[model samples]
Target: MKIVVKIGGKNIDFKNEDYFRVLAQLVKEGIRLALVHGGGPQITKFLEKEGRESQFVEGLRVTPPQDMEITEMVLSGLLNKMLVGIFHRQGIPACGISGRDGFLLEGEKYYPASGDRKVDLGRVGEVKKVNPRLVHVLWEGGFLPVISPIAADREGESLNVNADWAAARLAVALQADKLFLFSDVPGVLRDVEDRDSLIEVLSWAEIEILKEEGKIRGGMIPKIEMAEEALRGGVKEVFIGEGKEMENLPLFLAGGKMRGTKVVL
Candidate 1:
């Protein structure tokens, strides 16, 4: 089965051994997997080292020109290669690439407005188009495509794209059988402070209710929204679960069910 897996940047520091083992197993199973990753924490570290302060507007990083340069350096250069190295060490033939490579992803700039304040987040972009042919070619050639969230425009201007949105677009483009999003948390919890209150399955209607009741708030809301969008765009299924508990991935794929959340049509 073809799958698109999105790894969150926050989990990078955790060094989840299970995650790597699961990935190796997937490769051994001959599953066509495309990895999409975020490196916000790494970017933040770089910014901190450079004595640059980062501003966020509505939870989206407002990247200026210099910040964008650093972002490209970290996401494409540092984190992307790190993942590739991990896969290679596991004897999996993997190719690390940026959205700018072959113009796989192209997007327009986004300007978010908050009341009277209009923020100009330089280089921030939303995924507008995806060319999955590049990924398909790699997958057909027996190579996994590891993607970093950095797309370019028609004029070759690099833009910072949201990793979740990029993964959803790629999943739709590839007609992937499933989209897996790995997060630090277990899954969508009914109560923010209650770890045992994981929502195992959610239909569109159920998700709407959660949103209306404000049960789904903060970063999780966007993750769920992205998964919902992917489901609506024709991807067969989408799973959101813990990156640290990578052993559960195969179980989740095998219809064995997981403790995490599943968004289905």
Candidate 2:
């Protein structure tokens, strides 16, 4: 089965042994998998090292022109290649490429609605289109494609696309069987403070009700929105789980009860 796995950079310490073990297992499973990863934390660290100020409004980072350059440098240039190396070390043939490599992802600038005012986040973008030809070609050639969320426009200008949205779009384009979103958190929690209160399965309608009741807020809001979009766009299933427990990926694919939340249409 074809799967799209998105790994977040927040808790990703590349030296972590468990991370590599889980990644190796996924590749060894012989299931076609495409990895989409975000390196926001790394980018932020780079910016700080350069003595640059970083700002965020409504959880979206405002990428200034210089910051955009650093984002591309860190995400596509550094993190992308690192992941490919990891997979290769596990005996998995992997190819790391950015959205700009083949225009794999096309997008337009995003103006987020922050309360009554609109926030212009510079080169920040939302995925407007995904060309799956490159992905298909790589998969057919027995290579796992690892994508960075940095996209380029028609004018050859690069933009910072949200990794979650990019993965959702790619899942739709590939008509993937499952999309696994690995975040720092375990899953959607019934109460933010309770780790044992993870919501295991949620339907679209139930998600809406949760949002209406103001239970799903903050960073989770966009994640749920993206998952719903993937479901509506043709992905059969979407899983939101903790990256730390990535060993459960195969079990989840096998229809076993996973340690994270499963969102269905």
Candidate 3:
């Protein structure tokens, strides 16, 4: 099965050696994988170090010219290599790439609709196209493709693409069997503070109701929205949950018991 997994860039500990082992095992079982990762926390850290204040609009980072430079450096340079290294350590053949590579992802400047006005988010992009050729070739060659969320505009200008959205678009482009959004939380919760309130399965309509009730807020809002779009775009399924849940992904996809929230049509 082909799957796209987008790792959250928050408090996740990607260095967990066992996690890489789990991923390697899945690849060995003939599951083609594409990984997309975010670096929000890292970007903020670097921007602060350079005396630049990080800003956000509706959970998407506002990337000015200088901020775009820093973002590309951190996401494509630092985090991308780190993940590639992790896979290599597990004896897994992996190719690290940015959305700018081979025009894997093409986007344009984004202006988000906020209230009655369009908020001009500098250098933030909404994906306009996805080229899956490079990734498909790597997957067929038994190599995992790790992608960073840094994309380029038509004019070759760097733009920050939200990692979740990028993964969703890739899933559609690849016609992936499933898409997973790895997060710190277990899954979508009926009550934000209640761990036991996890919703194992949710529908698009239920998600809307939750949004109206203010149960889903902050960063999770856009992630879920992207997942819904992926579902409509032809992806068979989408899962959202903590990274630990991924350890049993192969089994989960095989119809075994797995813990997480599944978003369906």
TM-score of each: 0.93, 0.93, 0.96
Residue-level lDDT tens digits of model 3 in 119-146: 9778899889999999988887888999
Writing each residue's lDDT as its tens digit, candidate 1 over 125-163 gives: 988889888898898899989999999988999999878
Q: Name the better of 1 and 3 by TM-score.
A: 3
Worst 10 residues of 2 by lDDT: 11-20
Summed backbone clashes in each candidate are 0, 0, 0
TM accuracy, model 2: 0.93
Candidate maximizing lDDT: 3
Model 3 per-residue lDDT at 225: 94
| lDDT for position 228 in model 3 | 91
Instruction: Report RMSD for candidate 1.
Output: 1.9
lDDT of each: 0.85, 0.85, 0.88
Candidate 1 weakest lDDT stretch, 10 residues: 12-21
Clashing pairs in 3: none
